[model samples]
Target: MDWDDLRIFLAVARTESLSGAGRRLAMDASTVGRRIARLEAAVGAALFLKTPQGYALTAEGARLVAPSEAAELAATAASEAVRAEAGITGQLRIGAPDGCANYLLPQVARDLCDAHPGLEVQIVALPRVVNLTRREADMAIAVSPPDTGRLMVQRLVDYQLHLAGHRDYLARHPPLRDLADLKGHRMISYIPDMIFDRELDYLSATGMEVAQISSNSVAVQMQAVRAGAGLGIVHDFAIPFAPGLQRILTDRIALRRSFWLIRHADDRASRRLSLLADALAQGIRAEVLRLEGLLGPCPVRGT
Candidate 1:
């Protein structure tokens, strides 16, 4: 069977009109009709019944439509498998929460590139989850398991968050001295909607009110902390203090969070992605544990 004609038939079956299918496929109605007719002739069955209103799929057409869709999926899988067998030798785009990429990717990427000379890696620091449906990225490192349907998610490691401030800020403010002092302190916050719950819970428990210095980017927030605008909350590993930054609450008393590696369900077999995913998982696990140990383990559970 002519695959082009079958594709046209599938489009028409989905749209139920030659004109509609043509618009979708960027072809003319006549071209769509001809292709559909050719496909029907090759199949030895009437694929559609043309009525004044529109095209209606014949029983045979309905049956072929689903299998055709499945065939397309199978074809995509086969192509990815072929690429995987060819080895990790192409650009791999990894989308991640800004902090994760900053804290973990540098070493991981260096090692991967050194090990696989042919593989190139691009790390994108995204504020929100990249849309897998749109292929915004080949894979990702995320804080939470992404929407489950049609995604491949791997829980890499769980980590914790700490409230940190500049030593100078504390010195001038006379050191929080007690949780009660945070009530009037300035705070640099990440994206509000995705703010880790422990951040909020800590404030409530401590009888403090946060003054928000809102930032959308994690790198910006870290810089803000160094500039001494306010105390900022960040993953323990990402904070780069310049001899002045100090952990306000020991990790033992801080909020804990988890991280995951993810990829589009369809791109599971992309060779570059597979290698990158494994590298990221190992890199994150090692780095996060090292940082957590340095900062002191969180007293919180399931950390």
Candidate 2:
């Protein structure tokens, strides 16, 4: 039977409705019905029995289900294996959320390009997480370690946020005497929901509830602070990269963030993947140390 027919069969069998399967497959209802009919004719058995409630699989359909799923799994594996064998020659699609891409990716990309001259890198920099199971990206740099099953997870290093402002902004604010003094100032950050929990907690702890100008990009936030718009709690990488921005420390900035390197479970064994992962991990380590130096040294740990 055609693979398309089996694909429709699996979608319909798992979802138990022509419309549901069609939606998942991005096909129209009539098209799904026609394909299912074609599949049933080829198999010489009715796969579904339409009842008032919906469609239910027949005994014969149930028997076919396991093998169909196994076929799909085999196909998926074969595709990945083929791509892996192609080595670093094809595109290495990387998914990165905005913050990591802006403050964290340039060095890594440079290093990867130097190491793997044949490899092409396609960066899918997004403000939100990309779906790996759909092959949206071959690997990703994420703040939260992916819970996606069987993916390889590498904890790169921990990073910190420090309050930062431009020299002129700091001159006017005259150095924060204490955390409570922050109440009267403009504080910049991502939408509170978008910021990691540790940063949000640090903001809340100061009892300063200032409306943040909405920003998804760390680069944008750093620019806002440099323009004297407000004091920003920014990652060390973001601030140092901004040039002339100084840390505003009355006491330690309490927000600690972690970086994670994620790859497709199958990519773990691919030599191209291993090379890229090593390069990224190495770059991240160096950046962490650079950030520490910018912050004038702190008791921080590396990967």
Cα lDDT of all candidates, in order?
A: 0.70, 0.73
lDDT digits (tens) for residues 131-240 of candidate 1 = 66535567877777865568888989887667777767776674465555566678776555655433233334334454477666777888888888888766677754
- Candidate 1: list runs displaced more than 4 Å: 1-86, 191-207, 240-242, 251-253, 269-272, 293-303
Top candidate, metric TM-score: 2
**Worst lDDT 10-window in candidate 2:** 294-303
TM-score of each candidate structure, all chains considered together: 0.66, 0.68
Give the Å error, residue 297, model 2.
Answer: 3.9
Candidate 1, position 200, lDDT: 30
Q: How many residue pairs clash in each candidate?
A: 1, 0
